[model samples]
Target: MAAAARLAVAGHRVTVYERTRTYGGAVGRLERDGFAFDTGPGLLHLPAVYRDLFVKTGKEPLERCVGLTQVDPASRHVFADGTAVSLPNASRAGIVSALDTALGGGAGERWGAFLNRARDAWDRSRRPLLEEPLPADVRPFARDPYPALRTGLLRRPAVTLADVGRRELRDPRLAALLESHALAYGFDPATAPAAAAVLPYMEQTFGSWYVSGGIRALADAVYERCRARKVEFVFGTAVTGVLVEDGRAVGVELDDRETVEADHVVAGAPLPALYREQVLEWESTDEWPRHQQAVRTGRVTVCLALRGAREAGAVHRTVVHSTDREDELDSLARGRLSERPTVVVLRPDDERLRPDGDHESVTVTATVAAGGAWASGNLWGAAGGPAVEAFADRMVEAAAAAVPGLRERLLWRVVRTPADTFRETGVFQVPGPALAGAGGSLLPAANPAPPGGLYFAGGWSHPGGGLAHAGMSGALVAGLIVEGAGFRGSQ
Candidate 1:
């Protein structure tokens, strides 16, 4: 919708072909008995991307379109050892103070120093990695950006985010604090490049934001913006494949054996559907982007239609770190279900999400394997199967620390596993944002890919996923379309 709106504003007649009868792809919402919950992303980061979209496309700014709130104490982290810390929203000094008081032993200074290095990484890659088109020679971005601190005698460069954690943070709890940021995005800190530090840097710097009703509200606003710009939407019809003519994409072939001719086709669909349908293909296996791998991790969202009222002092977001980190990561790696998965608990203090002040909506989520028997089919109405239900039960248990009496207050719960994600969005995995380093192993496919006129927007494309990165991808696609080959990116 963001891309459609931008293209429409540029005087191009835009038509969005949606597979489902909705606008938002992954940014979906669930409603039951007046209780509402965001089934996709719980919060928004780098909101400036959408703010820019609204500014460029319409007279009404983002502020006027929807309500935005900066979550105070940004997020609370509950480590395995029962140590917890509340990092203030976009306040570096406050975060340092809180970490010192919570974790102790110069932990604050270490994290602060890491942030300083992370800032350098952000500065080095911001223009090329983001806010611009995917460069042809991605050599610069193929290297680590996070400046590794020299430590013990047997020192080596911090190759992964985990290395950065252990070498620098030094405390298990503090290391958990750092790794939680990466895990939230479904990145294995063990393999995610040190450039992955930019993830936390972005959230900590830009501050975590929330849409009034849910993150879904932002999608609604963007969709409305597209409609206002006269962009067309063909819902309930799937684009089976991109129609290629003379080595260039000219239009798309609908699933109904219908052909829609156009100058360009922006495929925002997941890669599995894209490749399976042969919409976009590379003759050589090496021709594909290095980072666009088969991501196995998918999210499990449990929406609790609780009976009790939300407390005035409830934190918006909380991360309950897994007690056994090794087991958790190992399970995800081997496609096995973890006994104890790290859970993210969201307890928004919004009257709109509940029937009244007496009711509250809480969302609990965790990452899990998405392939094979794990995400075979839709598990929503399966009488709460053993695997999903048991996993959800663990998630709810972990979330109880954040939302007191979580299980007791639950009037009803709806669980959306990887299968549901695959069913709804056509892919089980939730893509993380593109990052620099690991020899471009962390980067997503370029926007202006082979066989011109077929641009890949959304998470599966150049900028990767997340609300902000998805918006950036939309902007990049718009830029490529509007300016043709010379679209360097917004200045």
Candidate 2:
């Protein structure tokens, strides 16, 4: 939508072809027989990214689309020992104090020192790297992307997140908390890039927030802005191919074989899917062959949406760790889903987001199996059906144990496996591959695929995933197209 808005503002006749009926794609909300659930992402930390979109379109301010507030106690971590710590969203001193109280002797001071270092790294990298326009080539001398680390006074922490934390802070439990948060990004702190520690650092610096009605309102606002600018929207239509002629994307062909012609096309799907299915008759082009095989995808939650409206009490968030975390991950890597799963719950009452007066919708997610084991299931019978039902039961049991009296609150529940997700949104599923790709960092550059009038925006592109990065990718693709390199000519 950002891409469409930017193009429409520039007076280009823009049209978006969405494979799903909903507009937000992966960030969309799901409604099944009166129950509503945010299908994909729920965390809303960076509001400025979306705000920039509205500002660029000359639309109403973002606050009008959805009110925003930083969440108090950004996240609550419950341990197996009945110890729970709810870290205030932005209180550095407070968090350190709490950890010290919970863990004992010198831990608080150590946490404070570590956070201070993270703050320094965040300041050094925030503007000069993240918010800046990604240069076409970051491979020159003082400007070399590799050496920019030194130029910017940023030292590459030559250790994994787990390694760094252990080396600096000698507390195993504290290391677990820090590592667990990083794990949320689908990375194992043992091998995850040290920079990933910056995630919690930033969330604490700015805070964890939620938009007024819901996060999807941000997507809706973008859609409305595009519509006002006359950008055509074709939902529920899947693009089967990119019509490429003379190495330039001319338009697209739908699954129904209906072709829509345009001088420029921007795709927001996984790049691997685009390469595998789109770009018709492109054997003569370099864009679809070699570079197309570059990406490796990762997988996330097995989400469940409860039917009807009923408030999920006290437990705003819960994480259930399985006895076999490593083994489960290994199974997922081989395309097998785990029967025993870890769960994460973002209860409906987190921000009083439930329907009024003890009534609200709830969302439950279990980090179960992904890949082939999950992909082979029957999606329609998900709610009470064996596979999904068993997982939901385990999650419910775990959650109920954490927050007493949760089981009797009975309401309908629908479990969504990766197989179910692929059917719903067509997001390719890989068991345990890297979300950041094998390259480790999301440095910006021209499309690795054959360029020539073709471009992409979304989690599949550079600076991947999360709502902020995806929105920025859309804006970047729009800017690149408007500059006239004509995709194929960029390399």
The TM-score obtained by model 1 is 0.95
Error of 1 at 170 (Å): 0.3
Candidate 2 segments whose C-alpha is farther than 4 A from its true place: 120-129, 132-158, 279-315, 320-342, 350-356, 372-388, 430-449, 484-491
Please provide, for model 2 over 1-491, each residue's C-alpha lDDT reduced to its tens digit, 9 standing for 90 to 100: 87888899987998888877778777667665444667666667677777788888885877777777776667776654556676777898888878877778788798777777676656655553444443455432112111112112464433556666676676656665666665555554555555555677767777777765567766788888889889998888889988878877788899899998988878777654554554444453354432212222233343343333444445455565544555544644444445544556666443334434444455656543333212333422344266555656766666554444465555556656555556664544421211222243334333333447777666656545567877767776777777654332110
TM-score, model 2 to reference? 0.80
What is the per-residue lDDT of model 1 for residues 54-136, given as tens digits with 9 covering 90 to 100? 99999999999999989998999999989888899999989999999998869899999999999999999888878888878
Residue 459's lDDT within candidate 1 is 87
